[model samples]
Target: MTTVLYFGLFAMSFDFISGYTGYLSFGHAAFYGTGAYTVILVANGLVPLFPTSTPFMISLLVGGVFAVVLAVVIGLVSFRLSGVYFAMITLGFAQVLYIFVRGWDYVAANPRDGPSVGGTHPAGFEIGIPGVDQLNLAIGVLAGEEATVLGHTLGSTAVSYYMVGLVALGCYFAMQRILHSPFGRVMLAIRENEERAVAIGYNTYLYKLGAFAISGFFGAIAGGLFAGFRRSATPESSFYFLTTGDALLASIIGGFGTLAGPLYGHLFDETVREFLSKSGQGGGLLPYLRAGLGDQALATPIFGDMTLGVLIDTLLNGHASLYVGIVFVLFVLYVPDGLLGTVRTRVGGTLADAARDRFRDDHSTPERTEGDDE
Candidate 1:
């Protein structure tokens, strides 16, 4: 769960720029992987060179900073392009990174033994059992002989659930604020019509670069967590361009401009994966689903590629992405607003009705009631 939450943070950050700003960056996985590797590099030899005894908190912060810096570098290079060119360019960069990682025999062959990443933590800092300092706070404290004061330390699942939930919440609110800001207004203008926005004294380049940089920056943070979670940094495992596609799925499947929508999409996809994996198709949802019933009779059809066949039979059971993509296509074609958007529309209608009570006077009430009845 902690792991999922970390990925969610990166996804939310990606959501802010791509989901809200309308740039479909397909290279975010590079940032995510870079961030994870950065954490490993720092936590190991790098920390000792600069400072003494770098703790987990420091590791997390530095990982984020490093990813952001890398994002800036990537943004400056790629945001100048647009449309398919932009997507392709970002992909090219990610591929370049992937190739480098794959070819670097030392990094490639490494066993990925690094500092472990995450675990449990309390929500909001309320010094449980007053007078307890940092030391006593280790493993939480006792409130007059009861360990329940600060609440039980969350399990891995609970921790991840809460962590991801908070980050998602923060991302939603923060993006909402940004969308309502003057800069966000410029983003809207650019999205509506970039040429027109540029003509109206808005520097589209700067706006685009800013959005791209921030989006990549957050994605990198997610990548860093990915490496950290596994305590390994294999070239193939550390970063992959396909991962960015995952983020893109979240953005497109959910309405592009709405904050909560992409998150809903991402959550749905991840949750589905989790469900499928847990079911019996040899550890993958698709394969498990494709398999027959009665006592685990699953079929994993395949093409000629042996590696893919093996991996598919093992991890995917079949083409998980294909199945998921089909679902997305169907959703986009028919239910365009996505899972959350659908819910929001329903909720919006309910809330709108709830808002009418205060506006209704005796005369208006009768008409409103009639309208409601009708």
Candidate 2:
């Protein structure tokens, strides 16, 4: 679930630009990688000027700022063209970065494996107010601090979950506010019809550039959070194009234009992935079936050499991608608008608005009609 929150933020950032502006950023992982690498590098004292003692929050902010700058640079050239050409150029840039990072020795002794937090910073990354120790709490699976309230004790994992969740929630609301602003409306206009927006005297190019930068900033923050929690960053995980592909999958499953949809979509994705994982990280199907069915049932053969257990192991174990792909295909064919999107369309307004209207109708006293007076 913590993984879902941070990755969901990344997906939301992707949706902010690609979904709203109708410009796919195939290389969106570039900013994500930039942020992750920045956090790890700063922690390891590999980055110039920024010492190992730099606050985690400050490092995250610096990474986000760097991503914004990189976004502007990429957007300046890519936005000049539209459609697939722009996507390809952005992807090309990310691929180049991926290769460079993979081979760069400055990041770690083995750059291909990326960098991990060493003795320089043994503590978990703090997530609350920067300067106030009381207001801030550390977040990590093993490095986080635990607390006991009433009779219940919260473990380190639980603490990290709540802290990461708080940050993810804050970021979501920030993006939501932006999407409701005039600038966001302009982004929608550009997506709907660029030529029409241009005819109306709006500089679609600049709007796109601004949106891209904002998206990149948030994407980097997501990356920082990920690196903070894992205490490591890898070239394949951070800079690979497939990272952006995962975001795209979440966007499509969640609802491309709806800002919050991606989070729920990613939640669904992670749930399925964990359930079918071979490592049994979350008590996967293989373990469950093995435990539920006795040895007699396990030994029952369905075919010449394959028992039911073997069949289940072969097909369901670690094959989450197959089922997820099927669901994706079904969603594309039948539920094109996506889960939240279809709900919004059916309700004829935002979900919050619909709920408010329903509440008013249910509670408010009906007006006295003329017939009632008679």
Candidate 3:
């Protein structure tokens, strides 16, 4: 759930620019990776950029700044091109970064895969609230050090979940505020018609650059949270174009332009995946199906000695991705506006029609005065 929240926040960052400005960036992961690496490096005192050990929260902010700087540089070059050319340039830049991280041991300790920053205190990148000794962010279970909140004992993972969720919520609201501002309106105008926006005295290039920087800043924050949660950073996961692709997918499915929709979309995606994996486990859907079919039928051998139950479980576990892809295709064809967008359109139209009818009836009916009655 924490992972979903951070990923949702990241997706919203992408939507803030791509959804609003219609410029689909394919290198958003560059900012994400920069954030992850910066946060870890600063927190661990691995980089001389910060003296001594930096606070976790402070490092996160610094990481965001780094991403913003990178965004400015990338935007200057990438924004020069429009449409598919822009996307390809961004993608090319991200791939170059990926290759650099993978091959350079100076950048990442384990260049082939990535860097590892997880372990016990004093060894790993330990994050916690400033001046609060009791509250520390640790991934997974923290045995013998569990803290109770509101009479409920919360483990390390729960603590991380709450912290990350709160940060994600803050980021979501911030993006919402930005999207509702005048600058955001300019971005929308640029998206609708860039040439018209330029004719109207708005510098379209500057507006796009600003939006890209904002998006990159938030993306980095999400990356910082992710790195802290996972206690590691990998070029394959963080710098890969597929990372941006996942966020893009979430945005589309959740409803682009709705700041919080991606969160719901990501949550739904995660839920479906969890359901698929657990369906094959001991008390899951597979067991229920087997029980309903009974032993003889399940053992009836659909292929050679392989039972029906085995086949079903195998498909559920192994071909889960295949099923997800099919569902995505269906959504694209039938529900192009996305889940929330479609819901809002239908619900809003219905309410508007109802109100119009009510207004017509009320106005059409003449008031029965005393003289008229007589």
Once superposed on the true structure, which residue ranges of model 3 sit more than 4 Å away at CA? 110-129, 132-145, 278-284, 287-294, 303-306, 349-374
> Candidate 1: which stretches are off by over 4 Å?
1-4, 47-52, 104-153, 163-168, 278-322, 345-374
TM-score of model number 3: 0.85
Candidate 2 global CA lDDT score: 0.88
Residue 161 displacement (Å), model 1: 3.9
Per-residue alpha-carbon lDDT of model 2 for 90-128, expressed as tens digits? 999999988887877777746454543323354448888
lDDT of 1: 0.58
Give the TM-score ranking, best first. Answer: 2, 3, 1
Winning model by TM-score: 2
lDDT of each: 0.58, 0.88, 0.78
Top model by lDDT, which number? 2
TM-score for all models, in order of appearance: 0.69, 0.94, 0.85
Candidate 3's C-alpha lDDT?
Answer: 0.78
227-302: candidate 3 lDDT, tens digit per residue: 8777667777788899998888887788876667677777777766665654544254555676799888877788
Candidate 3, position 135, lDDT: 60
